[model samples]
Target: MGSNALINKHIDLKNKKILIYTGNSFGLNARRIMPSRPKTADGILRYAKYNIVGLVDSTCSEKNVSQVLPDLNPPNSPCDLKQAGKKIPIFKTIKDAKEKTSANVLIIGIAPKGGKMPKNFIDDLVWALENNFDLVSGMHTPLSLYPKIFKAAKQNSRKIWETRISPTELPIASCQAYKIKKPIVLTIGTDAAVGKLTTTYKLAKMANKKYNTCIIPTGQTSIMIEGWGISVDKCEGDFMAGAVEKMILEKEKEENPDIYFIEGQGSLSHPAFSTTAIALIHGACPTHLVLVHRPLRKRITGCLLLPVPDIKKVIELAEKTVIPSFLNTKVVAISLNTSGMTDQEAKKIIDEIKNKTGLPTTDQIRFPKDWTNLFMGTLEHANIRT
Candidate 1:
């Protein structure tokens, strides 16, 4: 989630302060029901160009963020570069974040269904624009589409960034992964928002300690963090895979990483996002995979009545679909999302997964060292060495 070494333009992120907006979703129950906002908040906290000063969640205002977000609690290290715990202040509105922290940017942290703006979220954006704060949105509805947001930005001399909108022109998919000699490993998931991006980042970080590696970010949050990546979900349906192919081929030419760790998005079983998921898998054409799952998850995040599928079925379906194109396509490791589970519960789930799948499994974000070791062993087994 750092800048690409090849990029020349640099933003002085350390000097800028950022405020995250979660609105009514910022409590224990909200963590499960509204995982996208909390996950986005944690990702920025772990790896962002700017400093995170406060979070806007009306329900949790005046409370310490460390107590609400499970990832920031004890036993799990902070994501800031300094590696120190900073008690982030929670505010009720964008105006509060502006007045208290003097934040320069407001990140639209929630990943809602259809990427639609929340009921009262526009009010917060209007207030931020009136105060001259730059707006960063990762939603399907671009801020430019709203006349009020557009006029406010022009009057305030502020910039509006819509990360989901793909570039106007993009190349077609060329199935380049088969032609390239370097190994490409993708981290996929059983359901959306189950720590696929986090696992990809952690794995790339670990691999870099011993091998030359780079990452392909597929989501809006990752694109912002990595400085360069194609937001596959935002692109036109036909061009999603090709845009991803172009990003990898271009990056490979510039950085020439020994291995490319492509970030995963959505799920094969997800009703709304399966098209993008398939496009990503085919575009990346990864030789091996790391399947991520959440043992406690009962249903798809957005669809309450849609029951979740078995982990085995998900893995089998993914592999069966890709075997014709990628002959050796197989899952090499497993990454579990065990946030809020007791130690014994987490351990039992991990052990059960290992026994059932006959593969290495761990709560990678909670215990990075263990994940690093497991992944390194997997790479060795696959004969993908530096």
Candidate 2:
């Protein structure tokens, strides 16, 4: 338990210096086309409380992380642009990374398509474990299951943190979340990987200033960022909702925050991940929902022929599907992922969506002030006391 040791406890990053293994997915093109693949690395680089010493990507070796992914240094970045450019170096391999920087932990930073560890990654993983560095991964394929990797870890006294493992004992969902009195805001998406986590995390950060806010991470990327969460996708179909409920109840007892922002997974309209979305809705029993959409994306991420429906229809689908079975969960706000659009284009679409849906809409990353005000305004309008 390297990173997973922080589960249900406060995170301690004093001694950990991370080296992110991004394989070949550490470039601007990957950020645009396959954002989800390098999401763990990007999230850690942007939001990790711990120190990220370097990155291991042969394709982008000798270049800094900021140079490879310039947009990572947003206006609100923790590190200044100039400092980040010189601080986090990228190396060609784990050995080079370790020799160059004091990174005692190696993180598998890509979530491949099928969740299986790529064959080419085995050698590097083994090398890292054999050395002094511990291993941390959010991939569905558990590194502990591999005999060679497990043996190397045991022999070297290194830890293997598999972030995607579900809890051993999970109670089946009995609509227990409905009993909680505090507002539970769930971020639902129009399609998979459409800024749901980013929206939830940013909103929680803003809300924490005025209210006691907690983020219930439902996916691996959020778990890596937040340090305590259950990856519901790794759970059995029947236990997915149960796992979510367990985390909510546990966090409620521990922190008792005024607001809990549950990071969403998948989409109700996407055939591949519809079940996870439905399970999250029924499990969290959210009082308010924030619908996240990528305005320019015509089709679902992996589906070529499946066209994304209109924003109005997506809102209608979410409300209709969740209201009848559970609490009166309304889609209170709209969070647009305006990644590839210019500011003018993003603003135009934001206004159009706001007019159409009659909801507070903005890109949280591009316009932090507007999003903060809009989110707080939406909460006040909904009578959710901050």
Candidate 3:
């Protein structure tokens, strides 16, 4: 089945009182130290459309979710317990969380390296399934494929939703996206897991106030948050771009948005994971690119031997790579992931990067007003309305 069919087949979030299973990686420290690991949980907490009752993380049990991650309380966040003026609670186990919050759904909230399910997590998943909680995971490891977990779900009449499955049918790319007249802004990165989704999401959210904007989710975490998207990284090598093109065309036909902000994957400079980046560039044929980088990260994540290339080089590579199919594509801005940096430090680095790359730069989450102006400027500079 294609992504649309699969999404329709599995997703049923209605009346779901959710309990996010983050295991040991569920705090602000873990998020700062390993941003990609708890991305699903973070994304859901910040932007999920469902009700998040509580969190299951043994290491941080008995603490409120906001106590552990203060920034999680965005305005009108689903995790906000507005009636009680309290944040969602965290429990050490699924049983405790479910009992306390009456949560009927369990979302696997980590994206470990290689998308592998750790033995402990697998045990927890089985327990949750047997106890009547439906499972939702954005990991590459499909919950439905696990024998014990699948049996438990079947016996308990629980559903399993996996977000990383690629479409069964995909056409080869013919540069179809270049035909779309609307401005398509793709968020490229210096390496994998460097805040591309967050930046794209924030930009699209801001742009939606004035323009009819769409966020094209391209990864598992993005798919979970957006409720529908192709996991481009899971697609076959030949059809990656085609899957993206299909999604864009479908969205255009559905929403007829004024602009598109595509979530990027991996890095064009990284040796271990560059195919998806190349596919997005060729497939989406974006008119504007926003480069996301972490100033402190000198080497590619998970590949110690490979150093990240300079900002200008990656920008030039992204812009020039599309020349054969799409002309005049530009890297319009720089999005710095200054997580763990002090205000002064973030400002200094942001300025340094802006001066070096000569592109408008800011940390989107920390400074939304600045990011909004920068993003709007990018749209105006690109001649994209609003």
Candidate 4:
């Protein structure tokens, strides 16, 4: 499915004014910034349909958000594909931002490890609620958990949106997603920020032109863009698998697409998100796996002790240790993110990966047709109608 199909779901964010709360971690400063880890505020600023008035971050106050994170889409502006990003006003506090921009909603923009609320956070949340702004958070720490914030929101008639919480009525995993007679590709990565979501999104949009395909977003940013998805990483460990199963099963029944491209979360070897990865692999039970990686990245993000394993090793690791043991999952293709590499370097790296793993490979951003053609060939060989 595409954005047009999702927009009809009536998300109602078009006219809503929202202020993103990034706190002190809004820039590229190493001490406060986490470039590899996903930023909630960046996602909202990029994907949300709401009128994002400003960003609240005391550390970068008075500067524009684009000045800090040049990678993100410019706040409410159009630019060429390779053009410089635009800027959004930065404020020191949510109250100040609300007053300055007339924003009626406060969105938590920081996505810390474990999704825990920052130690010094409740005061600002309560302040926003008391001031009558509804709350939206992708954090695992729900606002309802804080008595003061919860009480204030109730008293002020404000709604709290917890994006990470899985639906209570999710079905238990029966592994039925794998039983459907269709191609299902899950994008797994060697580490965080390695382009799993981007690869999956591209595949969905491109593949659907010739075949019935739908992308299942499994992260907060992707969910925001797709307009519907459960953040599987934030779900309780025991229920994560079931949550994924339910999502895929429902989409299968509802859309009945010829193929499914499920977005992946963190790396299976990364300590912070391994559990979620395991749940995703078992839950989705995909027939083919597309491994995404940055060929030049040397280590697992946020961990100095763990080195990134070789691409072939990772493909072997997933097949031997995780997927093929239960289902017929193969690393059919590789999606390389060559953001900082030159054309020659990227081509050389792609050739190296293809030779090493004996898998079709492409830099999805630079040469989207490469991956799309690979998927088409796979479908044709499998005798699956496009």
- Alpha-carbon TM-score of each model against the true structure: 0.90, 0.91, 0.92, 0.80
lDDT, residue 246, candidate 4: 85
- Ranking the candidates on lDDT from highest down gives 3, 2, 1, 4
Off by over 4 Å in 3: 1-8, 28-35, 74-86, 323-326, 384-386
**Which residue runs does candidate 1 get wrong by more than 4 Å?**
1-14, 73-84, 304-306, 323-326, 384-386
Clashes of each: 1, 0, 0, 1
Candidate 2 structure quality by residue, lDDT tens digits, 1-386: 34322222223344688788988888776565676788778767766667788889877644778776565665555333233434488888899888888688888888778678877888888888778777877878778767777667767767777788888888898778888877889999999888887788788878888999988989877888777788998899999998888989998999899899999999998988999998898888888999999987899878978999888898888887763354667899999999889999999999999998889999987887899898888786674422
Give a tens-digit lDDT track for model 4, residues 191-296: 8778787677667767767888887878776665556788887667777888888888888889888788888888887988888888888888777888999877
lDDT (Cα, tens digit) per residue for candidate 1, span 16-36: 687888777766667656666
CA shift of 114, model 3, Å? 0.6
RMSD of each candidate relative to the true structure: 4.8, 3.6, 3.6, 6.1
The 10 consecutive residues of candidate 2 with the worst lDDT sum are: 3-12
Model 3 clashes, total count: 0
Query: After best superposition, candidate 4 residue 170: deviation in angstroms?
Result: 3.6
TM-score of 2: 0.91
Residue 88 of model 3 has an lDDT of: 83
lDDT of 3 by residue, 1-386 (tens): 22222221466664678888988888766665666788777777776667778889977644887776556666633233331224788888898887888888888888899888777887888888778787878777777677777777777667778888887999888887777888999999999889888788777878888999998989887787777889998999999998988889889899999999999999998886799999998889888889999988988899889898988888888888873442688888899988779989999999999999888999877777798888797787675422
Could you tell me how far off, in angstroms, the CA of residue 190 lies in candidate 2 after the best superposition? 0.7
Candidate 3 vs candidate 4, lDDT winner: 3
